[model samples]
Target chain A: MFEERLKEVQDAVEAAMQAAIAAFPQSDLRDAMAYAAQGGKRLRAFLVLESARIHGLTDAQAMPAALAIEALHAYSLVHDDMPCMDNDDLRRGLPTVHRKWDEATAVLVGDALQTLAFELCAEPVLGDAAHRIELVKALAVGSGAAGMVYGQALDIAAETAATPLSLDDIIKLQAGKTGALISFAAQAGAILAGADRAPLAAYAKALGLAFQIADDILDVEGSEETAGKRLGKDADAGKATFVSHLGLAGAKARAAELVAEAVAALEPYGPGAEPLRDAARFVIARDK
Target chain B: MFEERLKEVQDAVEAAMQAAIAAFPQSDLRDAMAYAAQGGKRLRAFLVLESARIHGLTDAQAMPAALAIEALHAYSLVHDDMPCMDNDDLRRGLPTVHRKWDEATAVLVGDALQTLAFELCAEPVLGDAAHRIELVKALAVGSGAAGMVYGQALDIAAETAATPLSLDDIIKLQAGKTGALISFAAQAGAILAGADRAPLAAYAKALGLAFQIADDILDVEGSEETAGKRLGKDADAGKATFVSHLGLAGAKARAAELVAEAVAALEPYGPGAEPLRDAARFVIARDK
Candidate 1:
């Protein structure tokens, strides 16, 4: 049931994104944007839709926020894959934006996609003006200097640092890099509904950590074809990860614990939160 | 009077931007962002503050929007100065972001600065939620795929095209690349006050073209020391510019005419718009 619902949300968000990009004039920049935004698992969108559904809002009401997060996520990936960043040639089982076009196109596509995220948040259909403004503010906080970008900077710095990062340092980096956006996604519904975000925030904190652990695990064990990108990069770079600090089995166990904590955080929402709970479980269980 | 007021606005916006970036943890990324944002002419911020003043809004109410446009403008410069784009080594008489830092830091700094722009728009001091959302939406439209980015993509394409860009193509490109943000800055006050924006929009349209024409003229006649960046690159690259298409003398005359149009657009506000009229004249006359 959760899988079917996830697919439904994914389809809706994809269509909305396509429609949004379609409004721009035809160019390689636009084409690269569309390409970069394509083929995510849409887990973030799922979290948004599920959270909104739990809060008694229709998918239409939350669609813009969902699309916004996805666009923002795509932008991050496009930049992260650039030659000066991760230097990845592949993303989503296809050539990354810089590889397919050029670095300039990738940079512009990412920049424009980030702008599109805020634009979608301000869409009238999202809600009242106050609600939309809240969404925009939250997104900026989640993605800006003190959040995802900060984390990315830390990661880059760690690469050439005098020593390997400690476990606590890794946790801090991942929290800003991946965890911030996840928290924003989970709490979007509460933001729109003006409800308490504590429970969802708690849920996302654990879920995000678990998601990162799983990613580290995937890098260690998952196949490139299934993961749809390069694998074993962390090890090659000698980057400290959860799986490196903890044994593979121990990392898996920690992820399970985090997933359980995530599930418990959603207890306040009860059965209505089952999809989110399933999502938490799926984060660690999936191979990709 | 106009020059003094412009300096005051520039100082205020610069301080606000510094304070905003300082809130982030100490890192090279933050430093690079601060560096990239410093020392622009603050023309866009002046337009925003001047427009807001004309609409009976206080500087405090307009400062966020003013700072927002400058941040957005700074981000564009950082990205545009990259090796992949314009390959610019100097900006505002200092090394470009990528030259000062690594490419990754430059990219991340630009991305974070763009996010900061939207975050500023959402500041409570900007106005009511509705007004803030309008600012965010307008900013996104001005800076995103259909606006500045679209113009940049067109400019890049023109570089390798079989034919030089026609005069009409240049106008269309400039309208999106530079005109869009100027129009947004001019119209911000009316958006906040719920006043008609036609006059300010008209003023900005003319001023923006004149500004570009002046830039072209500066590339030809201005010294590298005064311009604070590499000059003569446009001619060296054989890029079609206003000076290239219309001749230096013809471009100067056209810029003068547009300045007149910009000044005329402010007739609705009588002498109260004198400062803005001076700004129009300054756009065509300034060395940089």
Candidate 2:
């Protein structure tokens, strides 16, 4: 079931990403943007489409939000890969934007993608005025300074700290960096589905944690071959991770727990929640 | 007349910035945010408010857009001051945010301010859904990769290149870096005032050029005591400028031409446009 759902989400992500690039006028920016977006896992984009499914939003209606989320994710990755930041040269077996072009082009591509995310969100297709406003707010809170920026700052600070971090410290960092944006994706879909704040918030929290745990696992044991990134870079950097805080077995258990919690959060939506449940299980079980 | 209009615009800016800060819950973020904001000439904020006045928007109705534009300006300055960017240690007679805090904090503060800009644009009090959407599009276009980011990238590139810049080169760079955002401010205010696209576009273009020429003048001759930034840095960096390309007297003459063009664009609106006329003249004439 999860495999089928993954395929479905992947298809949507490809379509949305392609459409976003197609919307732009041809320029040096166009190809760089396309390459930057081509190969992510589409986790945020998947969450958006899946959550929208739970709320009865058709793929047609959910496409724009899914594309917007993907654009933002791509933009963040482009910047994160810069020499001044994470400094990774490879993403998904492809050269990072900075390596492919130059630092300046990378920065501009990221900036364009970020702006495109908001521009796409403002399009007339996403329900009505109130819905679009809610979507924009959710994204800005999730991805902007208060959320992702804070997480990134914490990440940089954590690298140079004199003391080792407790597990809670690690969780807080991941929650802001990775979790916040994921939550935004789910919450945006929920808002489009017209879900009230309470259930949407709960779902967002659960999904965010589940996704982070999955990432932690990937960082620990996944191969550079399968993961398409250098494995164990976190340990090399002396950065805190779930595997560091929890023993390896404990980390796996925690991921299972998060998946269960995420699934439970979907009970309020009844049978309409299949994709979300499958997505939670997939998050924990994926090899990469 | 220009002095009276500048004072009114400045007053509106102070009120708007104060109200924006009021909406956030008090925290370390709030304190740091206030510190970053307290300094600056509020030129961008004034541009917004004055443009609105020129287009006949009431003080209360224009505050949101004004605050949003200021936030973008403040955030850009914060980032531009970082070590990897322009690396300035002083702005507006105070230690820059990066200098006062660590580079990490400065980065986060800038990120936060950028989000705050968008948040202000989306505020419910600003206008109806459509207007808010327009505001988001305008500001994003002005500040994002396609505009300011691209200009900044080009500026950085120009630093190392052997090519002597021509008139078109200087215009392209300035238009993206400074002119885009200035244009956005005018266009946003005009939108608020219910002006159609053609007139607003014309006003924005002239105002943007006029603002850049004034900046060039300040860089050349204004004292650090008066300008609040180290003067002559532009020449020192070998970065292209209107003063460099057009020569001092020629730049001043062109600035005056821009001011006249700006005022002429608003003639269709008659005396209701006096505020903008004053603003255009003031841009070239101010000490800082």
> Which candidate has the top score in lDDT?
1
* Interface RMSD for each predicted structure: 0.6, 3.0
Best by TM-score: 1
> How high is each candidate's TM-score?
0.99, 0.90
lDDT tens per residue, model 2, B118-181: 7777777776777787788788878875677667766776777797677798788788888888
Query: How good is chain A of candidate 1, measured by TM-score?
Result: 0.99
Query: Against the hidden true structure, what lDDT does model 1 obtain?
Result: 0.92
lDDT of 2 at A189: 75
Which pairs clash in model 2? none
Q: Interface RMSD for candidate number 1?
A: 0.6
Q: What DockQ does each prediction reach against the true complex?
A: 0.94, 0.42
Q: Candidate 2 chain A — worst ten consecutive residues by lDDT sum?
A: A21-30
lDDT score, candidate 1, position B104? 97
Q: TM-score, chain A, per candidate?
A: 0.99, 0.96
Highest DockQ scorer: 1
